[model samples]
Target: MTDIPEELALATLACRAGQYQTSELEQSEALFLSSSFCFESAAQAAARFSGDEEGNVYSRFTNPTVRGFEQRLAAMEGGERAIGTSSGMSAILSLVMATLVSGDEIVASRSVFGTTVNLFKNVLSKFGIVTTLVDMTNLDAWERAMTSRTRMLFLETPSNPLTDVADLQALADLAHQHGAQLVVDNCFCTPVLQRPLEFGADVVVHSATKYLDGQGRCLGGALVGSSALMEERLVPFLRSAGPTMSPFNAWVFLKGLETLQIRMERHSRSATVVARWLDEHPAVRRVYYPGLESHPQYALARAQQSDFGGIVSFDVADRAAAWRIVDNLRLFSITANLGDAKSIVTHPATTTHGRLSAEDRESMNVGEGLLRLSVGLEDPNDLLCDIEQAIG
Candidate 1:
């Protein structure tokens, strides 16, 4: 086991953060593929299960590979501990289930992922957990919606498709005043860019299935927070519910982390180039990249994130035109998933946000003409050419 030096740079941490080295002294982190660990005696097994001793007991809630990924991510996010989950949605589910009871309420941003909205509005509602949706950037709206029962505040900054940036510090302050925990989904801008915990947020969530994997290879998610919360709350929920991350996925994420910083930096550069081109193009009605000077929260994005992330969204003439562009694109993958090496183009109105009611979609401004692009590590000129031909 290794402890990363406090002064190491993020680039260094990405590659060196996790505790590694087995009896064989392997340079890379070993994947513990076994489903359960064998102990020397029944006493030792009881000790492991009862928390009287520290060692792997079962892969469902304890695995060295998964623990390594959690430790590395926690180190990167500046949190005391991190718990890995099966997927991004499961991370949010585990958080809610672990901390909030049926009578509690949640204040969430309307600009979050559509699946998150479903989880809150449809799924959690069945359990008597009420939720209030508010504009991510409107502090007054957040304050107005708070109630005595509010237990959690959730949002995704530089929100999905639109790149709507939220004031993390302000929201965190507001949540604290109401005795609610502020949970920030840092999926778009990994710890390499924005760290919500640094801005007073109580918890940071990540869809490790996205940029954390760098490639679209594995599914994983994480929640990072104080050790007390992870040990006392999240661990129990995971132990009982069994929404734990697989050791194989954890190993994949570990490999992805080794190159995360470099990938994000390149993704940012290419995305900026493509976004500027789109902003000037005649076919584009509007661009939603925080890197652009035209973005309303450009200053805040610059102040908070290391760079504008890889996603670039814009409006077209209509849904017909948007679909035509998606159909014509030769280089981009027409998938809902983003944060990949290959560019992805999606019509949020018909794809990601399709499940929501029309009124809800309208409220989120996910119009028929909207097109979201998960910019990749491709040549900007080639992507521009694809757009040029597709737009025509």
Candidate 2:
């Protein structure tokens, strides 16, 4: 692979970080679509399988295209290494399976994706791993939740559905004081907007299906951390469990990374406009966007992130009004997924967080009236017009 200078700007690194040309010297990245690589000799095969030599033996654990994606994303995140996985959820699962024992505990934010909440509370509980949920914004709650058995502290900054920003540095400090790793879900704010590792987080995870793909084209996820943690713990679990990212998807993500910085900037700019529009609208009771001065964590967001990100959420009168607005929208796709070139709108209480108990949803602030919008690259004026007609 080509060696990218660490001192280079992020945009330069994104475009040029992980290219390893073959004899063809292709201008664009070449896709290695084969399931396995050919070895020069039987001894070479043995050496590869035995980890004595560095070469691609199988697609499941090692592929040139996948390696390129991992390397580029790692560079962008400023991490020592990165590992790609099948999907966002699989990345989180791999991290947990690799690092924690059955008796270990997790301290997680209640403001995470609903599926993540289910994974921690329902699935992991069956294996004797307990997770304690807390408010993402409350330092006191996070500090109080830590225990001797706590192995991980997990959260999403600019949290899902609500756009709640957490203080990453404070949480990282608190986690380390308790001998725990702070694992941030950098899904909402891709590394283009916010690099959590820079703020003392031990590991940064991504739902590359979102902004990384940028067009809602593929499903992928990744973990970025010290090379020791990735190679020693995460890679083994990925190899054994077979939650591997496809080489084709990795190639697609590589292309996505090239445009990520520019796309994120556009997303942020348009989202700010949409957020402001919603904030002032008579129908919107509350607008949750860190870019707004009215947001509780606006100052922290300005300090920690390059931009406030693309997701904008707001509250209306009730579920009826929320559904009415959703049904009325002609331009925005009503889907649970976010981070796309095309705008998307979702009612959290009925869609993303529907599985959670009503009490749980209420506690997390995912109320029946809340509507989450993933403001896309569409003209801000057009988006506002679409929203205006819908709200009416």
Candidate 2 off by > 4 Å: none
What would the per-residue lDDT of candidate 1 be over residues 111-164, giving only the tens digit for each residue?
999999999999999999999999988999999999999999999999997999
Backbone clash tally for model 1? 0
- Please give the TM-score that candidate 2 achieves against the real structure: 0.99
* Candidate 2 C-alpha lDDT tens digits along 176-247: 999999999999988888999999999999999999999999999999999999999998898889999999
Off by over 4 Å in 1: none
Error of 2 at 108 (Å): 0.3
Per-model TM-score versus the true fold: 0.99, 0.99
Position 352, candidate 1: lDDT: 91
